[model samples]
Target: MGAFSLEGYKPFMAMVTMHSILAVMNLLAKAAFQQGFSSLVFVVYRQSIATLALLPALFFLRGRSGVAGMSVSLRGFCLIFLAALFGGTGNKILHFLGLNLGNASLVSALSNLVPSTTFVMAASVGLENVQLRSLITWAKISGTLVCVGGIMILTFYKGPRILNSSNPYLNLGTALDSVHYRWVLAVGCLLVSTSCWSLLLILQVPICKYVDPLPQALWLCLLSSLQTAPIVFFLEPNLSAWKINTVTELWACLFAGIFGSAVCFYLQSWCISVRGPVYCAMFMPLYTLITVVLAAITLHEELHIGSLIGAVAIIGGLYIVLWGKAEDSKRERNHIVDASEITISIDDKEDNITGQPLLVNSTR
Candidate 1:
């Protein structure tokens, strides 16, 4: 039992650490935006550093089993580029901008939408099966709907202040007043980013079949840098925007690039390889909990009734989806086991029949 428990404990700890890292990254990103850094410039710098960080891995770990097995083609390259565009450039830029415009808690809460969106997108592409008759399928579908409903409520509804805290940066009243005006836009940005992330995950399902995860992630960072370069240059033409003028800005970029982007990819890839993607996904909501605590302490963020209510609904919906997935996986494994058992029984019966015939011949 101790050994059995340890297997679950180690992975849980890894997930906890990952979420902590992400929460810190969100805080740092928000701080950088508050320091007057342009979103595009930040994204450019983050992707550039992430690309560099992944460069060493590509060379040293070149001959790994998965990498050696896959053969990249022109089409595979295009898919990688598309993945970078949707997942890397689009997702990162929108997420940063959203974080810039919104509080960390809001951004974190919206992150739950990734799986829901992934489900919808996968089904759209005919990759996922949706059987209305199956309770598991209904759970997933209903869960997605509930999650979306929660998002709408959170985005549109802001009732009276449920919980207020003193913010060192600004008075609570002033901060809430400012956020009220930009609330819708910030939510829109978050939604778009979440959509891009979903598409990225969906795209990777196909891409992973043909490309290795390490090289895939490295190319994603590289291609994102390339894709974002012109956009950053056009939007932030001044050389001053490119310059890192403060220690805070430099630290934020390094954290986002090295840990948040590069290291995170490897950690998640490894976890998926070990425990599977569903296990990794089940830990996502932990990010929101960590972010909320960090934001309250560091940024003096407030909590609203709507935020709480929506968060609860979203979490409930997320659990439903996860439960459905777990059940589906169990069913699949059972199916394979049953089929193998039937095949073995048939083989055994055939062997007995042949042996009986040989015995009769020997007796004669």
Candidate 2:
């Protein structure tokens, strides 16, 4: 009935904050990779460190008794743990592997496809209501298509372009003359990683419905660490090599685990609870935009025209989806309000005819 209120504003602000933090986390991940850290080691260390950082907050906020008393059914715990496995471990592993093989700029650009994946999943799962007749919905679909098209451009259309000379960041393992087959494999990994991450959004909705956000996040991190530990220890088995190299790298890892993994996850869950999963999912491209801009500034990464166009399309599409959702919610609320007003009016008319008060008087 009313325009955007403080209640609406709060979730929007939270989403923006989450996007910014996630972008910084991406930069940190890139920086760590540039410093010669292996993708597997980076993910394991980052998650483990994040779990430790969360311990203090979990203790202080939840208290010793609350922590001890907190429990879920074994089945519920399993579901949550599996979600973390797919999202945190599986997604990160594929993403890192892809980044190792592909250009960070290209990987970052392609990551914008996450929202489209999420939207499709949400709609299929009945979490999002899609009105195909609406222009907003059409715009959203078009935008998503444009984003995909941009990715195709980046992947297929390669031409010599001016590189950013001022940027100290190297392209890492990415070489334009690299084997074409490797690029194909990397692109496949990126696609799989994006799909897994999108499914993470869908999985999270159910997990949050069953448990509190903070505990859900803590368990996810805990399970991710547990799942990764054996692989890192037994299969990889290079503890000494995993040690931090520089103070900056250590800080970057810590920040990724603490703020990026722990706090951001919690905030995202909270936002989804207040705003709905569809609304939160729509803001994902905003995070990509933040990543691109920060990569440009901090990593001195060159921007391609295709990336810019893709971003605009992604953002525009997300806006359409969000607008459609918001309008749908508005209409539903208005319908309720109108129904309430009619009921009240009918009661008032009855009271006037019967010569009795329509509303009950308070005793206190």
Candidate 3:
């Protein structure tokens, strides 16, 4: 490789920061759930808050730089609305439902499905190439399978705890344990959420290609908030549940709205603009790892042998997928170079055949 590019570094940093924020948000959201708020209410409040925060920024940026221009069709608007439906509201609702019902670690572990599902969706829609003859394609495909396998292992096998500790984070777990939920239902809900999230990522490329990411993110949040408002009002019948009772609930709403929704949505849309959905989806395992560590440290959640094994598999799979993606990029770059070289060679031959002296070699 030649000199490292700062352009490459930014996306990595963004993804890491996004995942870290999400981990903290998850913990806080879990706390808020334990604080007697329904998951639907939390999702509604989170998106509403994020929409309120991002709307002003969108208008400000729109006036100064015209950054929020979408230039999309009615169909495009429809597509965007669908994206918000799945990625924004549906994804949030399902994830929170699963998280509230199941272990946070389990929710994170299941997130490994996003990249795989996104890969399939992309290939199906012709957003991603699938070259059966290419080793890189096989690598990418196998990586996805491996990730799924890891998820299956985690789901089926709890194994022995690798490290069981009494920690400060266990307070949330203690409070949360009061509400019991079926493990299978939680897993099913999470898997569906993962699929919806995959669709959202896949759909965003077309939606954001001409549009600015910030504005697209704003629309997503706004549409999501609007869509979920009625559902929240109907489901959360207790008027008192709408009020922020504790400092923890306030922090949870604030952090989730600011970091998880606004910042994360913008970054995610931007990354998809820079590098398509598959590349962005590859970061899900990283998010999973961060959540696992945070849950362990704070919730005093046990690090099970199965989870350890699954995490290793997921990490290895992510590496393979990333390597394959890099290889594909390199191959494309080389193909372009080869085409340029061949064009130059033919032009030179034509010059010689025409008895025209080539003044200079114009190839770079």
User: Which lDDT values do the candidates have, in the order given?
Assistant: 0.81, 0.72, 0.78
Return the top candidate by lDDT.
1
lDDT of candidate 2 over 1-364, digit per residue (tens) = 2455866688888889887887787777777777777777777887888788777888899898548634778877878887888898888788877766654655665666777787778778887667888775675577667667666655554443344542323332223454555665777898889888888877876676568877777888888988887776665577665778877678778888888788888888887777776677677677776776677778877654544554465466556655666676788899989888843334556557777866768995
Candidate 3 on 296-353: residue-level lDDT in tens? 7776677767777876787777777777878888888899898888433345566566
The C-alpha RMSD of each candidate to the native structure, in angstroms, is 4.1, 6.2, 6.4
Give residue 333's lDDT in candidate 2 (0 to 100): 90
Residue pairs of candidate 1 with colliding backbone atoms: none
Model 2 off-target regions past 4 Å? 1-10, 130-141, 159-163, 166-176, 179-184, 233-235, 331-364
What is the overall TM-score of model 1 with all chains considered together?
Answer: 0.87
Ranking by lDDT: 1, 3, 2
State the lDDT of candidate 1 residue by residue for 14-105, as single tens digits: 78888888899989988888888887899998999998988876767775654454447888888889989998999999998878777788
Between candidates 1 and 3, the TM-score winner: 1
Q: Give the TM-score of candidate 3.
A: 0.84
- Which runs in model 1 stand beyond 4 Å of their true positions? 1-10, 61-71, 160-179, 343-364
TM-score of each: 0.87, 0.80, 0.84
Candidate 3 residue runs with Cα over 4 Å from true position:
1-8, 62-71, 165-181, 275-279, 342-364
Query: With candidate 3 superimposed using the best TM-score fit, by how many Å does residue 204's alpha carbon deviate from the native?
Result: 1.1
Screening candidate 2 with a backbone cut-off below 3 angstroms (N, C-alpha, C), the clashing residue pairs are none
